[model samples]
Target: MAKAEFDTPQLKGIPVIPHLQPGAMAHSRPFVAKAEHQEPLGFPGELVDDWKTKAIDKMGELLTKYRALPVFLDACVKCGACTDKCHYYLGTADPKNMPVARQDLLRKVYRRYFTFAGKHFPKLVGAVELSEEVIEDWYRYYHQCSECRRCSVYCPYGIDTAEITMAGREILAHIGIGQKYSNEIIGKVHKIGNNLGLPRPALEDTLEGLEEEVEEDLGVKIRYPVDEKGADVLLVTPSADFFAEPHVDGLIGYGKVFHQAGISWTLSSYASEAANFGIFIGNYENMQKVAMRIRQAALDLGVKRIVVGECGHAWRVAYSFWNTLIGPFDFLDPKYPVPQHVCEFTYDLLQKGALKLDKAANDDKVVTFHDSCNVSRGSRMGDFPGGQFVIPREIIKASCNHYVDMAAETIHENTFCCGGGGGLLTDDLTELRVKGAVPRMEALKRVIDEDGVTHMAAICAICKSQFTKVLPFFGMGMDMIISVHQLVGDALVLGAEH
Candidate 1:
């Protein structure tokens, strides 16, 4: 994990917004997708001969299709509220990383080609022609954004920077410059049904191994079933949950919660992934395609309900977009939220007192929660406006003796991203990832100093992975990051055997 060589932002009580550095992160873009990576997602193998025209056509098509695109593009008044809000701009001191300016990369092109003012008086409108230089800028800065929508929270116009970033990425992809990390994951979901590309046979082996491992580690038998037709619930989780650190612990937590609650659930190899990278790349067709696999799995399994595992952006797509993209989901039980979050499910059981929890089991360490950005701003939990924030904390409290929050502004809907979202988690963007995490890391540092907080709990796979990789750069232990459900597994009491 590479730390920033540039003077990284200091962990101060309040972050001092730095002055502009014109091209600080210009060299920090991810690796471009090759022919093999792009074709499956219906993208060109590489940059096409007529890329400029294709890029413009794609932008025009997007503007027409998504009403928000045109609305956001036409909406900004340059109030600069969002200028200081983006973590990238604060961390990298790159003016172009400012949400409004990043939007202008495409907005300017839209003006030059589509608007009368920009067409006749391009210089007056800050518009530019669709040249290679502009395209290069799009490729560079757009990928630097994590699409966490933190700026949208402060924008008076309610402009969503994530959507603009997605549009920019989509335009780049149409020109055959798709990103390797996300495009490859999208392709994997299309072919192998998950990002990790673990086949059904491998998935089965991993789940079984997890079951046995859990029994040994915690002295309890739990079933992480797969492909069990007619099960009451179909567990559709990120493939990373099958075996990633801190993430795998969350996976164990989900299984233990289900075991104690006695909810009949099984994992689906067909729709193993909750993540829909189509939303990441701003490709509605691909997003819908990846989402439909869940619908297919639910029907095939004859399960009455669908429960998604811990994933940040995946939950956003599932909660906000699933119904529109691939929904009705009428075949599944109507009582549930179609695809319910594992957190919501666990929280519900805790509320009902359906399972026993030994909160003292977590007394050894103090805990704090990092609200995954997508869950905070993009979606909800348990039918409330801020249930996304409340439920996770409530669950952690139930399973722990001590808990703390970072800061009033830094939490809930205003939470900073884990710095590795919107497909920027690839190794190519580690510097951006490490530096972008400054605000979040600073918040955590305060809690550690003021409240003696030892562990930070997160629900998103990307959040867990990002913190695990980058925490050490700031002199924090990598293991300081843990899953919310991992706490539940720690304190959850299975039965009266003792």
Candidate 2:
């Protein structure tokens, strides 16, 4: 229960190999889910009497179901190719934070139960039996991984540690060992339809408030519609956008873009949240349940297109998984991609010169774009391979006078996670979150010092929320992190300008 004392290290603008500290973050663990959270997600209410056996059985089930799990466990030759790839390793210098080391936490357990060498001569193959101590180690270290897959990009055999991390969490959850933050949020979404648990009345009231604010500022009554049947588009954004700073600003920007495009769009209180935390906990049934809300909303609303707001993992689920999770979309119009990113929608408008944008509107500030991990590597945008990286920057450039990127190594597909991803954004992991952000902070610092960048814009709500909190720890202003569409809203010219 004692908090680990983490001495904040100074960044030298170069990666430094830290002394291996085995138990540095052993105490960093998330809250356990209660019966309410666990039962609703189809997990046991509490740790079963034979949890060790059940956990091992769950691991066996996962290995049989997912070939990647078995292949990754057997394939790693300890070549150290991925030793230096993880941001957590770079930040904390904990050897267990290294991707391969993290994978071994579960791999060792797999070997003991399944592999002959591991079962007979366990010490030689680095295998260990499934015991209470090993289970506790799983709880501590697996939560440290953000599932960013940055390490996989460097591995010669394309060994994805994210797969191992997901398997580890899934097995833990099966034995009544769920993380409270993610399970509780999933419960809320199941009950109230979004992560924040904002009710339909509150959602409508907030949209109305936004309508009045836009009318006051722009002198135009731009609509933030909710559940309006027969609309042209149904906007499914993260619930954080309804209340959180910079996220709310991006929501306002979406309203402005839709207003300018002269399209009829409504937000469904039924599917208000785009974020599917089910992906974080590696629960496919829950992920599908979360995703089905959107399909139902689209059906009920009779919307022609589905446009998602500024959220990272939500886009991945929508872009990559939705079709498989709840799709074929035969009931809706076929004009668009079935579901489209708000950035792609706005960028398409820019390409067609549909909206009147005054780039000088953002003249007072110099901006940089942060490529969110899920969007950058897990999914793609536009028609090309790297469009996820290109499109966001293009939008910033078109909407602002000055835009600079962070270090070439730090941006695009090689981007570091915002440190609060993969359900680790809760207050419980504050130390881990802050330490995990060291590399990103160093990268952002270089840009700030060199380019006079006043703000960094992100498309992910978690990124915005994480940066707003962690940036201050690095002596940067909390307000330095802005939403991408916050810039778009600023630079957009309304009322017959086109």
Candidate 3:
């Protein structure tokens, strides 16, 4: 994970709102998608001849389809409740990175095209036509956002800037503009069935390798099943879990849980990926298309239950959007939630006293949980709103004896982005990702200094990968970030075969 050198934001006591450095991150935009990646997703291969008209028309379409977009555009009174809330603004000091200013980039365009006051008294109402410069600003700032929605939580209007950002991104894609990191991955998911594009044979080989490795290490015959029809559960996880460090460990953890709980589960090569990049781009069609693959896989495999692996935005799509995008999941068991988080599944097993424990297994490291943004703000687990926060913490507590929290402000709904979400995890955006991680890193640093916390557990694959890559650049060990289920795997007790 070599990165282009950039100035690292100094960790000087975790400033809540650092002094402004306008244009400090003006150069942090990500690589745009090419025609090859865009066309399969129903977008133009490149910028169109009438991209301006197309962009404005697409905005109008979004405004009509999503009622909340216009309200967010019109509702801001410019109160500064969200002023200090964005991790990008805190980390990079670019004023446009401020949630309000970012919204204004699209608001002005909305005003010029759709509002009476903006159309007539355009200057008076702060309206501007959708010009090339405006599009440039939209591309630059929107890509900088992780779409974490932390500012919306602080705003009096509850104006979710993430939606605004998504609308802006959708408008860009319709006009022949898209981010490569997300579009390319979404294309892979559609064409080859996963983000990593690992085919069925390779996937089977990887699972086989994991089985042998687990046997060598644990002396237990844990199985990683694939395409086993009639299994009760279908496991859909991010492709990163197939091989990425910390992420792969979590995959192994999932297998261990299913084995011990005696729950029949299988992974579908047809719908191998849980992540839906459509949510990142704000394209409902593409999002739904990706989700439908999972639905099809469940039907084909005859599985009654679906469980999502450790991912931030992936869980959000599965827990919150799956019912709408791919349901009615009536063919599956009606008693169970349509799609469940792996944490929820494991927690249920633990609650039912189905799995034996050895908490001392994780005593070597003191632990803290980094609540991933999508899981914290967008989705829920265990039948409650904040169960997304509580269930994972409870799992960690059950697994490790020395568990503590980072800064109070940096966990749960107020949590910071891992700086790699919203499809901005590619190496090209490493500078922005590194800087955007400052606030969370600052909180993590405090715990390291005060609590001697050695490892941070996360359910999101993006958070684990982000911290693993950026922590080294920030003078921390890359291995400090870990998956929550990795801790669970460490503490589980296995007896001789029954």
lDDT of 1: 0.89
**Count of backbone clashes, every candidate in sequence:** 0, 0, 1
- TM-score list, all predictions: 0.97, 0.98, 0.98
C-alpha RMSD values across all candidates: 1.7, 1.2, 1.6
Candidate 3 stretches with Cα past 4 Å from truth are 1-5, 496-498
List the candidate 1 regions with Cα displacement exceeding 4 Å: 1-9, 496-498
Best by lDDT: 3
Against the reference, the lDDT scores of all candidates come to 0.89, 0.90, 0.91
Distance from true location, Cα of 140 in model 2, Å: 0.6
Clashing pairs in 2: none
Question: Rank order by lDDT, top first?
Answer: 3, 2, 1
Q: lDDT score of model 3?
A: 0.91
For 1-498, candidate 2 gives per-residue lDDT tens digits of 425566666767765667788877878898889999999999999999999889988988988898998888998888998888777888887889999999999999999999999999999998998989988988888899998888888887889888888888998999999999999999999988999899999999999998999899878899999999999999999999988897999999999999988889999999989999999998889999999999999999998899999999999899999999998888777877768999999999999889888999999999998899999889989988999998989999999999999987788988999999999998888888888888888898888888899999999999999998888887889998898998998899887565
Clashing pairs in 1: none
> In model 1, what is the error at residue 25, expressed in angstroms?
1.0
